[model samples]
Target: MSQHAEQAAAFVLHSRPYRETSLLVDLFTLEHGRISVVARGARRSGSARRFTLQPFQALHVSWAGRHELKNLSQAEVPQVMAPLVGKALLCGLYANELLQRLLQPADPHPRLYLYYTYLIQELQQSADLEGALRTFERQLLENLGYGIGFSHCHPGCYYQYDTQQGMIEVTADRGCYTGTDLLAIAEDRYETVDVRRAAKRLMREALAPLLGVKPLKSRELFIKTRRTA
Candidate 1:
């Protein structure tokens, strides 16, 4: 049996060329999960869908398919978001890459979809780029059921996070973090550099297992850009 959707809220995660004049688009939709759709004639200069299908814009897309790859019938931008540039743009790409890698297709995560929308908006406006990335990373991990707990110790204590064992209290010198920093991160209070750094380390540890062998290309791109600049 075939399936069809109308005006589904979505954003293009990534796109690549297909055939002579079409494009294969990966989309993150509110009603559905990650999906691949072929945008016929999207590569053609005169195609209107080509413009509307770019990332960071809110789209109302219609598609149809019985198999994994769908045919993108129509797409229209209901709202245009502020364009992300520099580091924010890289962060946006990183988020998209994470979703494409970690999330399974056809698994609808409405809350995550909303969080992503908010995350993109936050990245566009927030000066705290690391903090914003950490917040979204934490949220994504939590939503995927790998949430880390920070409530195990008192403010003066020290703790270490283990991917297999969660958070564990440790001697002060051996500890990864003081309880104060952990608490701040738990509350999303990334006002200080220390908290931001701790959050980044913790998120890296948490995401490593899920990501497995393949490293994120966006992260590689970011690192390369940083080295050249």
Candidate 2:
């Protein structure tokens, strides 16, 4: 990544308190895939940026410094829409965690950035939240070159996913995914319960190796909330 940039289109993926009066913020920038910046004094009560630096808001950010963790020089959220609440907020956190964990630092993914922005914006009014998340997961995996290939899949056949070789044909009795479900997923069509269920499992399997052993806290939070509700 370059040492500095000004007024870049960005969104706050995550943030945490830093020292006594600053914040360590993670941003997803169009030019920089994922980055951390030190928001100096943004924790001060009177700082104008204290509220500006938040998730689910659009911002133009400026940062400078020669290190991997840059200093946030300026930030302003120009597109302040209604804040995400309830399940929508949880879904946003889940997406943030995925990007922060999977995306390589300083690697530019302009297409993935657009997908992410669309997903986040859609979550605000999305009636099909699970489908939206699955779509974004597919986009993220594809963007990272780990997408599950369905080229060899055929109708009326069964299949299973292998991390190393992608989708593989299998006998009906031994297969984890039905040909119909695979076909539906290939076309991004979740018209039935079976297809939706298969899509969720497929996404979990594809993301597992990339995510490793540590479980995502956002997922846990959402699951626990569901149990209580």
Candidate 3:
């Protein structure tokens, strides 16, 4: 692969201290998809790069490497995003974790990049956080080619979702969903509480296989926050 230095629009999905002063950052870039880079000396006090390497903001980043991990040469925010707080902050982290866990490295997903940018903005301002998250989850799965099917359900009738069998008309309540709710979720309409709750359940079911056995740390954080509150 080419090791030519390139600049791209990006966002920091996750980051952790590397060695002593450097940082290992996972970034989602518009042109390069998900990538990990070593931000040398980023943790040192007085390093200007440390301030610029933050999540929830649009960034212009440049890096160079032939291997999986690149060396981050420059990073700056192209635009500021409103800081997420409270539950929204946790929601943003959850989104980041989902991307980090599910997205393939070095594979560009321009559309999903746009969706993620919008998801952050929605989390910042949307009153319906659950709706926003469910929408993002659906789009993420679709982008990854694991799109859920909602067409098989009979209109106005109750149905159950089988992870392997798709939607099945329900004689008894097997899943926490109605045919109307499934259709609403398909159309991105979570107007009622019932629809939103069902959507969340469906999204969870859809995501389980891809996520495998390891639980998302971000999700665990959310659970703790809820229990405390």
lDDT of 1 at 195: 84
Tell me model 2's lDDT, rounded to 2 decimals: 0.87
For model 3, name the residue pairs that clash: none
lDDT of candidate 3 at residue 188, scale 0 to 100: 91
Compute each candidate's TM-score over C-alphas. 0.94, 0.94, 0.94
- Cα lDDT tens digits, model 2, 155-176, are 7988888999988887877438
- Candidate 1 Cα outliers beyond 4 Å, as residue runs: 1-3
Kindly list the per-residue Cα lDDT of model 3 for residues 1-229, writing each as its tens digit: 6678978999999788999999999999999999999999999999987777777767899999889999998998767778899988999999999999999999898999998888888888956788888888999988999888888865668877677777767675655467888889999999998888889888898899999999999989989999999
Off by over 4 Å in 3: 1-3, 174-176
Give the Å error, residue 4, model 2: 4.4
lDDT of 3: 0.88
Segments of candidate 2 deviating more than 4 angstroms? 1-6
What is the lDDT of every predicted structure here?
A: 0.86, 0.87, 0.88
- Model 1 has how many clashing residue pairs? 0
Write one digit per residue (lDDT tens) for candidate 1, span 51-157.
Answer: 77777777888898878889999888877777889899999999999999988887888888988888887888967777777888888898788989876857988
